[model samples]
Target chain A: MRTHRFAGYLFILPALLFFLAFLVYPLLHTVYLSLTEWAGFDLKKITFVGFDNFKLIPPDWIFWKAMRNTFYFVVGTTVFLNLFGLGLALFLNNSTRFTHVVRTLVFIPVLLSPVIVGVMWSRIFDPFGVLNQILEKLGLIQTPIFWLGAKNMALVSIIGATVWQWVGYDMVLYLTGLQQIPEELYEAAMIDGANRWQMFRRVTVPLLKGVATMVILLNFIGGVRIFDLVYVMTKGGPNHNTEVLATHLYEVAFWFNKMGYASVISVIILAISLVFAYLRSRLMSEEKA
Target chain B: MRKTWILLALLLLCATLMLPAAPKTTLRLWSWNNEGDYPAVFEQIIARFETANPNAEVEIQWVPYTEYNEKLKATIAAGDYPEIPEIHPIHPGSPMYSLYQAGELLSLNDALKTGFPKYFPSALADLTFEGNTYSIPLDVNNLTVFYNKNIFKKVGQKIPETVDDLISLGKALKAGGYMGIAHGAKDGWPAGDLYFQMLAYSDGSHTMLRKADFGKLTWNRPEFIEAALQILKMNANGVFPPGTAAVDYFTGAVQLFTQQKTAMFYPAGSWIVGGFDTGFPEGVEYGLFPFPRISKVQDSASTGGVATNWGVLKKAKNQDLVLAFYRIAADMKSAQILIDHSMIPPYAVNIQAKREILADMIKAQAIAQTRFVFTPELHSQVMSGVQGLFTGEVSAAQFVAALDRVEKTIKR
Candidate 1:
């Protein structure tokens, strides 16, 4: 038993070191930096302006706008991505050659670089873009609805793109979990005259609870942290409407030369991440129990 | 496990392959050129410089516009950098106030004492730290309001002579399909500069700046709050388009102007001249205006400083080459070509300073009598708070209070 524990520690050591160096170290340092006014680049001289940075938080509406956009994106994507993923997972869990090909194709978006996805989608949302051109030809409406033009609609477009990229990832995770379920149990249930919904609810869903918990948590984390696609596509613009935490943090630290304030926001984000992670793991435990 | 290790190794390989190894030859340039398409200009400039001087080559990179100071801080921490970046668009001036205290950038007073004064005295003088010029200007840009001549003609709104004329005339123009003026409130800088125009004309050039310089926190001064209120008043009058606050300078200007949605777009001359047709949209009948002075304002004759300038990075490998490049680029001949192409050329000795296309633009510059109106530093500081005020998220008093707070914080 001791030997097995030792082997486990050895196996985990590299990952633990990586997490400490990249994640933990940065988090701790950022928390420290949050209390000081360092012009982000110069480390030697950081004026300790404790609490002043935090006080500026209330007036910084752009910061709140970003956080709001992040939440909306997270919630919107989390719900839709799970649904689409589950639908895809169940459709392909008993895959034939055709379904396997379809699954692989659906996963192609995940394979594509996020920056490329953003750029391509931005082109699609252009006023005379392919999607609009096609929709117009189909007699969908008289005039094109500006996808990224209006402030509210811009957030919707980002949500759409994010869900599209992540649905496959969620689907693959659920599919893996689905593959582990015993076929005999489902067959037995059917033989006992359980209907499709009944088998799904009583057996499949209850069994997949652990996977569902993880997927939702992962989706939540991803939704909050999303930056690149939003940055590239909208840049939180048409009047700073779509701005989120990561992008705003980048602006504050780098653009505005307010490293202290940026660090405070970073620490807040870290706290949020940790809370979500804890809740996720707890939910996972409850589901398993 | 085998597949995962192989995949991890492959990923590492790809990451390593992506970062460019340090070059065999060394040249360092610090520029504000961030857009991918526009980096081509620097490439051309670098290629020309390299051809002229064969011993060294160049590497071009971008600094995030917002976190530029942070990147500069990191470079400072790194102990050695090739050269400092040039022409930081929004530098608050008082260079190295903190950095100088730490001994970062060099004082370039010697360069200023030379004939460099003759090239761009105003640009050189403004960036002077403690009565000495510390940076050489590569170029100068000024804010020029480009009205769609077609829109102006349709609206029959001749150039507004006073703020009230604008308010009244713009309303009548709003009855036409075109927006009276397209600049909006949500955008931080445009609306802020619009106030700068008002303040410059009203002898408020140093209203906020004095507060900032003296650390007095006087943003509640009647004129300062009233300046933003004037803009909001115009916005409320529907002088700008419906949903005006939502439009960015780029979208509100180019997007609307191209669609004939509005009558005027206020952007700097560098953007106004040829930039629109190539990148944004094709031609709309365009003409330039100096920032309009209100009818009875005391300093209506002064121009606001929206100058684009160049500076040398301390670690720049080809500092002499960059200096030489500026000398050539700022020459009268080059300035003429720019003016002939419809630019409001800022070089003092420029060849085409007398050109007809640039006549009104030049006249406006000549009329910018107070001259201090242009730096935009105070305007830059108070813009966001003002934008918040414009958006109704804060009251006018709250907006002034925000500026008052900034004045307390940043005033050296």
Candidate 2:
């Protein structure tokens, strides 16, 4: 038994070393930086100002604006992404040639680079772009609308593009969950006079909870720390209408040269993610019990 | 005697081996895509410099323009910056100022005095802080009105010379179903120049912004408010295109201008002529002029000055080699090279005009030199205020007030 345990430790040593070097050290360093005021260029210039950077966050209107935008995206991306994912999975859950083709087509956007998706969507949202031209040709609108110009519509446009890109990822997970559900449960419910809707409500929802939880948590984390699509698409512009936490952190760190404040924002992001993950694990354990 | 000669040869060889080797200095240079063919031109200059100084060598790193600033800041934070890096004159909050404050930039006073002429006085003044010069002036770029001659001919109107004429012309072009100005406010930096131009044209002073930086004046003054109003007026008069807020510089404004979809464009530099030549749309006869003056302002001026300056690291080991390179870069020969490559050099040099528009552009810059210095930071507050003006989130009064608020936050 002692020999076996020693061999297991030996086998895991390389991976453990990499994890400590890349993840653990950097995380601890970032936390240390959050307490000090540094310009991010020279080490000698760093001043230890405990909690001063975090104190600046509450009064900073830009931080609140970014927080609000992040919250909206998190809520918007989670609810809409899950609904669309489940809907698409239900529609194309069968083993047919048509379903296979549709699934491949749906996954194509996920295969595209995020930056490319941002640029493509930005062009598509242009006033003279293809979408507007089609809309105009169909006589649905007399004039082209500014998809990314308006304040209310910019976030909506970003959400639409994000959903289009990530919904397929969710669909694949839900589809697997659906396949694992035993057909006997459906037949048993049918014999007990339960209709399709009742059977789905009673059986499908409960059985798919694990997959649903995974999808929501993954997407929720992605939405909370979102940066790339907003960056390549809007760059927190049109008067910062689309500023999120990650973009704001970038601006603070690089543009403003305030590394300490950026670390504070990073800590906030990490804490939010940790709390969500912890709650998820607790919920899963309770469900098992 | 033959044995004696052999022993002498061996002694000489031993002496040669005893002498220390000459240390070959390696200087790392970081630059971004400032213009077309310019990077190649820079590489050639480096090769020539290397040939002249056989004991030294240079390594150039090319970074994309979009990510250059971020990457540079991170690299510097990690204490791994190259010996020299390209610095911008109008970086928001002034990255040059931050680097200088952190003692990361080398003072180039001795270098300029030794070799380069006093060609970029305004730029030098801008980069100086507390009696220390931080960077070497490299090139000058002016913001000008690039108008489509065919668009003007279609409307049967000459290019506007004053703000009122611009507005009237814009209205006429709108009536004719064309955008008056192809300005993109999506990036927020381009539109701020309009406000500065207005202030400089009206006030006849380019120091208002610098004054604000020193807390000598607030932004809600009547003149500044008038400048903010001028932008709002332009927006209200249908001068800018629909969805102007969504269009960025590369993908939207430049595309529309080149496609002849808009009549006028405010390209940030004269090098845009190169862009026009490469992607020549048929029947597109473009012209350049300084931004027009407001009709009511008696003293009118145009905003013009250096766009970017190169700086050396303070603790860089290759100071002599870097200073030698600066001397070469600032010489008239390098200026000629710049003019040949379709870039406006910081120093004046005799060059045959390749095109009539290039000559016109050079003449326009000379005229603008006397008018006003480039005061980009003066309008940084207004840059942020553009979306509010477009979205009706802030009134003109509120906009000016917001600028005042922003002024208070500037770290000088």
Candidate 3:
């Protein structure tokens, strides 16, 4: 037993080493950085300021705006991505050739580069772009609606594109979860005269809790770290309405040359993600009980 | 005896082959020239340089203009910058000066004095901050408007010489089923450039811009407020293209202007004039005009000078070879290449502008009373304020207040 324990430790050593080196070290360093002030680029320029960087964020209007926008993105992306993914998984859960083909088609968007996705969606949202052209042809609107150009519609448009990109990812996770349920349970539900909706609510949902927890946490974390699409699409613009935590941190670090302030923002993001993940895991554990 | 003779011959051949073939040096040059045939032009120039100097090789890393500065900053931050990285000219208020203050750049004054004697002093002064020159300019640039004369004629309008004239002309063009101006205000720089040009006509000049950069002048100053108000008025009066906030400078404005979808294109003259040869439609006559002078502002000036420049890294290895590359970069051949690309060469060389509009641009640059500030941060602040004004997110007063707040924060 002692030899087996040693072997198990040896087996985990590489991953533990990697985690410490890449993840833990960076996290600790970032925390250290949050306590100091440094213009990014040259470690020697760092000045220890001790929580002043954190203090500055609460009063910054842009930071508040970014937080509000980030909250919208996180909530919107998490709910919509999960809903659409589950819907897709349910509709295409069959093992038929047609369903497989449809699944492949749906997942094609996930394979596309994010930069390309951002640019493509930007063009689609253009005043003279295909979306406007189609909407006009359908008699939905008379004038061109600048989808990405208007502050009201820009975040919604980004949310829609993000859902479109990530739904397939969640759908695949859900499909696997669905397949894991026993056929006998559904048979017994039918024997008891529980209809499709009843069975889904009682059996399918409870059974899928673990997968749902994983997907929600993943989506929430992704929403917190969202940057590339925002970078490419509007650059958090049409008057900085689309600014999220990641893009704001980027602007502070690179554009504003406030690396220390950016580090503080990063810590906030980490803390938010951790609290979210912990709450979710606890809920999952309670569901299991 | 035969074996010994063979061995001696082989040794001689080995010694001859290993005699250090001119100490070939490879220098990495970073540039923000990731657009149509500009990279090709640089490649051609590098080829010429390599041919002239057999021992030197230059590898070009073409970063897109949008991400160039951020990437450069990251590289600097990580202490992994290239030897001959591109630096914007040394306006004291610019990010380049900030980099200099951080000791990131090597002083290039000696190299410039030794290798590029003909480089204009006024231009050199633009890149010098507090007794140290940070970069050697790649080219000089001036901001102006290029208008499609045919479209103007169709609308029965002459080139606008004043702000009111521009607005009126824009109205006329819109009525004629064309865009008034192909402006990519979405990119921020276009709008910033417009404000800077307008600022030059006001009490604000390069000095005022520099003052704003150093937190000496507030954005709520009368001159700045006047400039901001004028810009807001221009946007309100429809002086830009439809969906102006959605348009990008390169793919939108340049493309639309080249395709004759817009009547006017305002951007950097030196950079935009090159499109006339390559992308512009055949027989589409265009004319150049200086940025229209505002009616209320007394001072008159234009925005131009050595804009894009390059500096050696403080940790740059092979300083002599890098200087050699600078010599090649600033030589007459390189100047000729720049002239070919519609850029004003730093050295004194007579360029016969092929287009009449380009000729006007060159003449205007030569005779301008003052130049715009090369400070990126000032321009960025102005851009955000102007954008806020355009979007009705902030009133002119609020915009100025926000700018003042930024000045305070950055100063801290």
Candidate 4:
């Protein structure tokens, strides 16, 4: 018992150190920063104004608008990503040579960096860009409606770009789950006169619930933190219509140097992330049981 | 005999080692973007100084324009100040002014007396803070109107000379399915410039920027509300694209004009012919115009000076080389090179008409419009809030009110 305890401590020390340095310390420091104004620099002066920065955000309607945009992004990406990822996995799990190529192609978008994806797609979606040019040549619309310019569609446009870049990531997770599924179960279902749809609905889905649930939960936390894609595409613009919480925190901190106000935002974002993560993991576990 | 020979060999080796040490100490200099993104002419001058002072070796480090400010700030914060850098204060939200209040900016007034009297006077004004000269402005880039001749020709609207003509021209161009004025409001700076240009109309450039300061929440004031009204009218006139709130500057508005999708654009002098590819139709005649105010103001023609300025870090290691670089940068040879690269001269010049394609911009510049020096702090406030006003999302009242509320927060 003494040896086991000592070995456990030795095994965890490296991970604990990493967590302390990168995670716990930063989180606590940021919380402390929220109480005092420090623009990530300027050690000379720090003004303490507890909860005042939080109070200031509500009156600034743009903050609420940005929150709303983030909510839209989270819900939009999370729900669709799970469905599409699972669908692709189920279709490609047959393990034939042709299916290997299909699986490889399905997983390609996950490899691209979000910033590069944003820049490349901006050209594809521009007025005279390849997309509009192709569409015009095909005589689709009379004139080019700027993909990023239209206030009504800009958020959706960003979502489309983000989903294009991440659906592959979700699909790969589902593929791993599909592979773990036993061959005998499907064979048994076929013998019992279970059609492909019935097998998928009953055996395949129930067994893969663990993987699907994990993927969605992980994606939800990531979804809320989405910044680079939206920032590069729209910059929360057309009047904070596409602004998310992370970008808002950045503007308050870097642009305005309202370190205290920025910290309050950072704390709020962290809290939201924690709550979402906890709820997602709970729901996934309950479904499996 | 053996002892004498060893002594002679040692002395000869010592003499050879000291020969290469005759040159002056070497300094490393960095410049941001040959694309003329620099608000001052520092790099072009440094090259000339190296020619005159052969003993002093200066190495130039080329940094890309896009993230130059970010990278430069990181370098300075790490205490690695380059010998010759055109510094801008980061606190006013340009990322350069933040370093200024921290006392990282090196003062330069004592060095500029006889050596740089003909130095662009406004350049000195830009770098000045708390009655001390902190930077030297190589040139001042006042705002100008860039109009597309192709769109003007197609719409049959002759170029507008006066304020009313500009507005009416916008209305007619919209009817013709062409956007008349397309400066991006997606970013804060251009959006604030949009509103400031109106204030330039109401109170003139000098009073609007310098006197009626944005330090207070003058939201309830008539002037503040009227400033918003100008924005609403211009936006309502349908001169901007339908979804302008989403467009970022440079990548958005500049591209629209360059691509011939928009008829007119109002931007700082940094952009125009050289900002992008000038590959317009062979007959396309681009032109520049001064800011037109309400015909009734005391100074109806005054426009704001929206120039980028450079300064030296306070603890810079190589002051002599940097100052030497600044002096030779304003020489005529450097000035001619700047002109050839599609930039206007910061110093006084007799611009000959024969110098290629920039005659229109030069001609418009001669009208002698007064300039308002927009400090970085005020510029930051405008950049942070101006975009919201233009999208018709935040009313001018809300925009100014927000500015007033935050000004006290950041000013401290």
List RMSD in Å for every model shown. 10.4, 3.7, 3.0, 4.3
Q: Which stretches of candidate 3 lie over 4 Å from their true place?
A: A1-4, A183-196, B1-23, B65-81, B90-93, B96-98, B204-206, B296-300, B367-378
Model 2 lDDT at residue B178: 85
Number of the candidate with higher TM-score, 2 or 4:
2
Model 4, residue A147: C-alpha shift (Å): 3.1
- TM-score of model 1 vs. true structure: 0.77
Residues A128-189, model 4: lDDT tens digits: 56787788889997777667765566788888888778888888898898888899999999
* RMSD value for candidate 4: 4.3
Going through the candidates in order, their DockQ values are: 0.12, 0.54, 0.45, 0.38
lDDT of 1 at B204: 50
Q: Tens digits of per-residue lDDT for model 1 on A112-143?
A: 88899987887677554577779999999676
Whole-model lDDT, candidate 4? Answer: 0.68
- Candidates 2 and 3, the one with greater DockQ: 2
lDDT of each: 0.65, 0.77, 0.78, 0.68
Candidate 2: tens digits of C-alpha lDDT, residues A149-188 = 7888888889999999999999999999999999999999
User: What is the lDDT for B392 in model 1?
Assistant: 47
Put down candidate 2 lDDT per residue, B184-290, tens digits, no spaces.
77777676666667777645555676566455787777777777777777778777787777877766888888887789887446656667766557767888777
In model 4, the Cα lDDT at residue A13 comes to 100
Top-down lDDT ranking = 3, 2, 4, 1
